[model samples]
Target chain A: MNPPILEIRHLDLQLGGFRLADFNLEVAGGECVALMGPSGCGKTTLLETICGLHRPAAGTIHLAGRDITHLPPGTRGIGLVPQDIALFPSLTVAEQLAFGPKLHRWPPGETRERVLSLAKALDLTSLLGRGLHGLSGGEARRVALGRALALRPRLLCLDEALSGLDETLHGEILAVIRDAIRREGVTALHVTHSSAEAAAIADRVVRMQARVPDAGERDLTANPPNGRWRHRSSGPPPGPEVGRC
Target chain B: MPSSPPAPSHPWRTRPELPFLLFLAAVLLGYLGLLVALVAANILTVSPAQALEVLRNPDIIHSIRLTFFTCTATAALSVLIATPIGYLLSRFRFPGRMLIDTLLDIPILLPPLVIGLSLLILFNRITPSSCCLVLGGTLALATLVGWLAVLPRSAPPAPAILTTLGLVSLTLLATAWFTRHSTASLETLAGDRFGLPMTFQPLGIVLAQLPVAAAFAIRTLRTTFDQISPRYEAVALTLGCNRGQAFTRVVLPLAGRGVLAAGTLAWARALGEFGPVLVFAGATRGRTEVLATSVFLEINIGNLPGAAAISLMMILLAVAVLLLVRLFAGNPPPSGQ
Candidate 1:
């Protein structure tokens, strides 16, 4: 059996005031995992840490079965589309799609072919030579996806990539993403606030809660504090901590 | 409240940009009033007979010709110097960049008299004014030693013009060659980099204005690029631009207007700079004399009518040049573009 492409073990990251602690995640190859958390909950931080844009205070990242916690983002073969879709200003659609592959010394003809196919799929065939400044939000998001997938990366970490899309375009984008993940078979970690997103595509769901103020070294003890909880089909209410997001 | 002054009603007060307009008006009136008063006084003093006499003076004609000739040459040289320097400062980061920026402002802020003295110190210090008696004293005043004590460009200059220009040209040629070689190697080893091509290099007069003009260019471009949503670049990168391709194609196009404005404004400033010309090149009548020197000498000689004529001419020329620049730089953009 082929192994899972990405594995995260108890990732812990602290940056000034915000902290992501007791973080554990795993995505089987060809699997899409949607990360959910409240505002200021470090969902994006977790993505950045995995993609090597940030560091986890304590964590282990295994990509394609090789540990890559300390590797630079460029060397890790992990592609990220930040929430803002950080594209370089001076490059065009086609050039944007080729950035990483060129960095890794991909052959020109193959890179060009890959870019063309990717462009065709993203409805960007007409937009290949066009500069990116004038594109609509939905169009920009699609281009971001194309660039990430162009490298044929083993892992794609998307951080709230649809924050600015309209409802109709959002559905179209979601569909495109589903088809893209299947066609590419890359392990994907998608962060969003919507549970509908997780239910739509995730093979398994893992819920994360923001660290509470003054909580010392993770309160792993179960049933220590008596708490009134709301029912969830006969389960206790997720209460303040778990359901807040 | 005793019958307020009808809320100071005017179309200007109610306009969306009214406050800014009023602020600009007050500043303009305050600073320009003295200059306007002086011009009015000169015009009042000019009689028809005196004006005709002033117009016929040969010395006045010579001074006017000399001043403009200097301004044009100096401006051309300044522009030649500023372009690459601006590009380098803006696009690259290296040691002493801040110091270079500060050094440039020295000429901009220093008084003309101090500038002249600085030039003297730079050149004549080595020649020891005693040697001025020999070598025809013409060579002494016409070149480095003269400007060293009296100019900004030559002051603190590391080498004389002869030595400096030849060395700078060689360095520029070598750099161009090196850049070409590296680009070729990179394309062979790692193809399709988007970094800017070497053909954009500035020349001659443009190079002379490299410091201030380039500084302005870099600031304009950097700010423009910064304001652009980098999300676009990231998206394009993900699409496939490789770092080089992404920037050239995506980011630069997005910032094209800003780049154009920066280039034009730098060119305009390079065209106007005067102090450096006077000290570095001297008022050698038609060689280094520019608009400011032409006006200065004519006014100082008590030839009010002649001075007014040339002053009006210089101002008109400046206006024409600025109009051409504005076609590219646009209406000052309210943000000093």
Candidate 2:
């Protein structure tokens, strides 16, 4: 198995007064981990924190064996496709896909080639010239996926990536995501509430709670001793401590 | 997109929208009738030759040019300032942000005369004596110095020397003009105690126009930026764009229609500004006169036909500007409040 490409320890965050304490997780390279939690459990907060959109109150985030707790999002080599599927309204599908490469100063020829290849892979060839607002929900979501993967990031963060799709569309997107992950072999941390979605795509699942349980309430803990994924079906452990697995 | 529910069985209750629509239409028609009557009365009262003569008057021609130039410059400066202010208000949260947002509305809400009075008081307190000369000399020196500083060090010395000579001559001419025109006004406002000539000067008109017009520009643009999802910017960032790159490449292009709308609205408002301009910059016949002021000037002189002629020009300017903006910047969808 590949080494862990993403490592989180003792993460503490308070978003709009909702506190997430001692949050810890890790994702091995090429592994797809689904983060499942109830609404308002800070699933998206963790994802945003990892990508540097929101600063953690405390804790360090290491990615690809490098400490990146204070790095800016653009330099972090991480891609995030938010739940809203926010395609730049002014850009065409092709331009949107080319955005990352262009920002990184990729040569014109190579950017074009990569855009065309991604468009084909995501079945967006005919829609490459279309404006973002004209795309359907499924189409826009797919374009967002293509955009996130355009940079070939070391870690991809998806926040409720398939939340709005119908069952068939969801399955289709799931298949496409699986194919892309298999092809790129990049680590992924996906946030969703759907257990079926987690089962469909994740190599392992991580659950977070709105409030870390008190020490006295501690029961079964999924956190193993070494900071690796451990499944627990019973009542939540008092809480997982930082680096205590 | 959903259609409204059917009204009640009673005819009056069933068609409530009809009365509302009719009431609004009547109010609109009332204003429309007033405009039509004004134009018709003016045209009938004056001969075509008399109107043409008024337009050809040196004072009238000069006023027209001054009006367009000052208003355009004010609108341009307001837009430049409003863009960043609007962006910051839309994108960031900070201590005092709410206070700043509320304060921005003060210019629009306050009477134009109040704003003008406040500016006069401010200048009086800060630089009452020799304000004109100090301001004029400082501006001239700064411009020339800035130009010289930007010249390439490795360029041929001959061109630089020639340009320096030209700049000096231009500065001297400007200084002479500022000294002659600004002195009398300063004496008038500050009375011999402190000759700070803001009243009855072109600069005074611009100063009066800036705040009121900038309020409209900022309001239009802030609403536009607020309506746009910040997610687009975040996505751009994830795509490897720095903050500046994201703003220029993604945010700016999307907000182009809004910027145009804001500029057009500010320009129109500046063109119509009279109260502030009158209070801050006295309606000096050939100097501080704009189309709006010319109307009042002609009216005060009992020249009804001349006033009508100036009012017609204002309407025409407004229509032309609105048309150009509509043609160039296609209308952005209105935000639901």
Best by TM-score: 2
Model 2 chain A: weakest 10-residue lDDT segment is A224-233
lDDT of 2 by residue, B1-337 (tens): 9999876786644465789878888999999999889778867877787789889989999899998898888889888989988988888653345767998989988988898787766565443234544555654565465456545422222244446545665665565555554433333555555544665688788888999889999998897788777777777777777778888887888788888888888888899998889987879999999888999999999998888877777878888888866764565632210
Model 1 Cα shift for residue A206 (angstroms)? 5.7
List TM-score (chain A only) for every prediction. 0.83, 0.85
* Residue ranges of candidate 1 with Cα displaced over 4 Å: A1-3, A8-24, A38-42, A52-60, A67-72, A86-109, A126-135, A201-210, A215-245, B1-218, B229-256, B300-337
lDDT tens digits by residue: candidate 1, A48-69: 7787656666769899889999
Candidate with best DockQ? 2
Prediction-by-prediction clash tally: 82, 4
Q: Give the TM-score of candidate 1.
A: 0.59
Q: C-alpha displacement of A33 in model 2, angstroms?
A: 1.9
Every model's DockQ: 0.22, 0.32
Instruction: Put down candidate 2 lDDT per residue, A117-199, tens digits, no spaces.
Output: 99999999999999866687788888999999999999989888898799898999989988888888788988888877887
lDDT of 2 at B1: 100
After TM-score superposition, the amount by which residue B60's alpha carbon in candidate 2 deviates from its true location, in angstroms, is: 2.6
Q: Looking at candidate 2, what is the lDDT of residue A70?
A: 81
